[model samples]
Target chain A: MLKVEVDRTQCQNFGQCVVEAPNVFRLNSRDEMEYTPDVEDAELDNVEAAVDVCPMQAISLALGR
Target chain B: MSPPVVIVGASLGGLRSAEALRRCGYAGPITVFGDEPHAPYNRPPLSKDVLGGEVTHAAVAFPQRAATSDVEWRLGTRIRSADLEQRSIRTTDGEEVRYRALVVATGLRPKRLSPRTATLAGAFALRTLDDAAALRNALHPGVQVVIAGSGFVGCEVAATARQLGCEVTVVGSAELPMLGPLGSALAEDVMRRHVERGVRFRMGTHVAEALGQEAVEGVRLADGSEVACQVLVEAIGSLHNTEWLDGNDVNAAQGLRTDSAMRVLRADGSSWRDVFAVGDVARFPNAIYGDEPASIEHWNIPTETAKRASRILALQLAEDPRLDAAIAERFAPVPSFWSDQYDMSLLAYGLPALADRVELLAGKAGGDCVYGYFVGDRMVGVCGIGMRSEVLKHRDEVSRYGHVPIGEPAR
Candidate 1:
């Protein structure tokens, strides 16, 4: 399992992360990015893409023990 | 032991660096320091929707899932000293934090009018959210607003004020607005557009002083003309936040000099292994452009540079092949930016400042069209105004390693 996080203080909600991982991340009604923190191992590829596509570089993932 | 990553400046660049570090699978402790109290919010909308009263301050908050990653957010604080040799930073609160890797993203601050003028009740300049909010409150119907500059920020504010039914006048020393970037031909079109929207332009006029006893009442120009207004919004350019690095060997000036990989360069033009810089605070060379170090004040470079910095940090920690050469090439992505003014949406691909020639590819002057700029024979940049589809198409072509054909198309 992987845990994804974003620094709310730094993100500008440009939605570049959503384009990288649509399932794990999304832009809320306020036009800010909303996402689930935990993702299945199978979705690692998309999550990694989210990590790259984020314009504000506002996403992070941690491998569980 | 994995060293803690210290990020200075909680703006887009620093914030993105922290996020990129997590994305790169660094589970080590991360700390972010910001000078402002509020959480990171989108600034583009501040001059638009927020000023137009279409959105509230809370509405601009960038969304993040609560469990994204555990990060130590030190808000309302700033890094007073960065000791690169010791890899430590001292904050304004007297706390010292050591880092294995540091990302400096301290963005620029707006150049203000003299303190005497700024101390006036209604004088304003928009750089942060608070600045925007204050400027927003002063925009009411029939409020005479005198904008000091006609650059991107000034033009945007003028449009917003016009939308709010405020009497707006833009004062600048340029023959045409934005001649420094878009050149005379295009700047003239921009000036025409604003003029058609009821904005008065005082070209070649310099401000002698802002006239007011307690509050902003008018502006005295060099030509001995007084333009009266209730609000004075100065949209002059910005000064990069690099003064804190004084006395350090780091090549610091208007911005920190960096390479393609976003590594901060030393005085002798050597990259600092553990020190990286990004955003408006970094001045670096563009691979596509010439060797001149280009410093973009746009929103895209910071986010892009942060990701590149994160990759380098991860590789260094992992002890991967010290392939700095390969990594630098992969990190140098094309520069792109956009801005929205009134009903027109402008998108620019690549860096136009490096271009030698510009041609109107599809649209009329100021109409819906894609304008292509080139450096020698290569298509370096494209600017689109009201031509979103064409812009996207050309953007895709440019991104795919394509170029604009040598001569004019068979129109």
Candidate 2:
């Protein structure tokens, strides 16, 4: 499985993540993103997409069991 | 097995998120919904280039290479409801989209004048490309223009109006323009700049009403003073697009409240891991400023936050080992923003709201110079008028959380 994390301290709510991994990352009602912290291995491609799209460069990932 | 991705609000944040996803190698189909009929475009230049008649609307179109992932554009459609539990969204067109994840970048709208004033023909607000186009047409030579608020947008409009040869008067209740961010002293410099350029200032005054019948004929000040003008532009502030999420059980006010990871916070102040928010619509805490959450309205912050959100999402998908640590380290980017008014270019680094004190480091006031804002002894933010190269060099250091001598001059 893939693991996801966002640095809220650095985030300015730009919503670039929504465009990158719509399956895993989303902006909630207040125009903030609502996303899953973890996903199945099959969704790795979309998760990677999320990493590339975050404008603040606040997103990070690590391989896990 | 592909996961569905749905992004609402097809503007800068939406477009950049889509681009970032493609760059990160996501081949899944993507859907981007926008309330506007036009394709995603840059908005920064709307008040300047487009209004100045220096460039056409087409010139501001965000250049996109066809190879960048293809996004299913749902233009001219508004999202009526987002059923977070159902993992779906219902659009105004009655279409339901099921998504494994969602991104809300609905941004904010400009606050308008009261209905009593909006009925006047000359009243205007600039927030979108269309709004700028309409205002540009209304600005003609010899027109007397009265602008409300002395904020960045209002100041830019005032400068532009003067350049267009219009009789411009800016009315504000503050002693100087932009006292909120630039402070009264620097704001006075800005006000003086406009005065030197022939722009008039009605300082320490408030607009009681915008007067006119068919069009704006004049404005009534709180002091009972009447200033006649042919046009009025309201630049008071912006309202976040969060009313739709009313029953969504999320902790949302003017903007969505999010943690460092861009995840929406519950009403009880807990993170809602399943949902995330980005853009001007979300309010999150800053690490450098004692963890006080800030809602910034700038072009650069949104772009940077989206990139960080993407990386976090990718780690989750890859089952990253450092996921917990990564999330904890999120929200560390230094805040930065810039604005162009008349011949002056103002660049700001760090959050001015968090600064306890401000001092001029280099250059003279009312001229090309660099000013640094400090929180105690550490330089928390920097602002420069007409000094781009010097400011750009210090931006990285600020972003990396570097500190300059508090009261020392910038040599």
Candidate 3:
């Protein structure tokens, strides 16, 4: 599993991450950004992609604890 | 030891290129040259947040990756020129570096008018962190500010300056700001928003001369009008930084002309497989837009082009059988750009400027709305304010629109 972190203050809820990693990140009813804390190892590419697409540069991923 | 793949321009594109090369199983050495002393940092906020608050390089710099930890970063080293035939570049500090392959990602420098017309002290152009920091210091409450070119950066800075309590005025040669890209309908809404926030617009005219002795006191417009302001910002446009490739025989005058594979071309239209360009400096054809090659300066282009370039270039370097197949893959990157002016966040996909016709798809003209940009009957792009989901949905549709594929798909 991989750990995902998003700086809420920096994130503008662009939802670009939602488009790239649909299985991990999402937008709530209010349109604010939300994401899974842990993702499968197979999702590393998708997760990295989500990190890249974030206009705020607020997303990061690391190995799960 | 084999020469490293040297990537010029140590910004997002250079960093992404290095990472993509490693991902493609290229075990060779990599070197990235950047003129800035600081490492790669996101530049979007330079026109927004950094102008409102503190300016720190560490706050915005890209996180260090273990994969590229070994990659040599020649920061603070400016390349004077490149010798394409010799496969080497010389730095301004009298250092020569050779590379087996080169990635041109030098990007651009903001085109300035005050340098010749007015003093540099109170003039600004926001492209780097330093520019933002300097501009931030000058943006005091109730200070008169004049911005040239009411484009993306100009309108953005106008918004930021207003937030800082600066009396802001944007000089534009169009009836509305962002009229070229957003079109008149959406652009009028944007201008209205700016006007509501106390930002003034001087439309259908541009700054002819910035007048001052010690610093910019005001500007004389080409229409024989004058606006007095203490601070002047020229966000007119950007000039290509392709001068370093001067004697290279490549058609870099417009931009570093490249094929769909990112291979740079000679003036005679022959491509140099070893030299590639990504980001704002590269001009490549988007079949979705037509066969006419253009340099799309959208923020997403650097990442997309670098990844594609590195993927194919890695295969070629490794002599992998997959090289030809990789080159044959269809690369139709949907250009995306966004602007955060106050509470109104404008997001778009595809090239809106390429459209001859625009139709309102959703919402009110004065409020949150989505616009479909069309070239004749075919939809070419989409732009919206506050309708993120609706706007994003059109990305695929526009990307698939008129995709005259130059090569066979990998599948």
Q: Evaluated on chain B only, what are the TM-scores of all the candidate structures, in order? A: 0.91, 0.91, 0.96
Estimate, for each residue in B1-411, the C-alpha lDDT of model 1 and write its tens digit. Answer: 766787888877777788777777777888888998876766777776578875464756555533335878888998888788888888877888899888898888888878786577889988888888888888999999999988778888899999999999999888877655565656777888889999999989877789989898999998999999999998877788987777677887667988777889999998898888988888876554444465777666777788888878878777778646546574445566655567666666665554578888887886766777766767666777755445545654444343322121000
Q: Residues B281-378, candidate 2: write the lDDT tens digits.
A: 86776565445455777776666666666556656655678768879893765565655677676767665544568777777887877777666776
Q: Write the per-residue lDDT of candidate 3 for residues B42-149, one digit (tens) a residue.
A: 998889887788989976789888888899999999999999899999999888999999999999888888456433678888899888888899999999999999
Supply candidate 3's per-residue lDDT for B395: 78
The number of the candidate with the highest DockQ is 3
TM-score of 3: 0.96
lDDT score, candidate 2, position B347: 66
- Taken over the whole model, the C-alpha lDDT of each candidate is 0.75, 0.72, 0.87
Candidate 1 residue pairs that clash: A4-B68, A5-B68, A5-B69
Q: Using TM-score as the measure, which candidate wins? A: 3
Highest lDDT against the true fold, candidate: 3
Comparing 2 with 3 on lDDT, the higher-scoring candidate is 3
TM of each candidate vs. truth: 0.83, 0.81, 0.96
User: Could you tell me which 10 consecutive residues in candidate 3 chain B have the lowest summed lDDT?
Assistant: B402-411
Q: Rank the candidates by DockQ, best first.
A: 3, 1, 2
Position B126, candidate 2: lDDT? 85
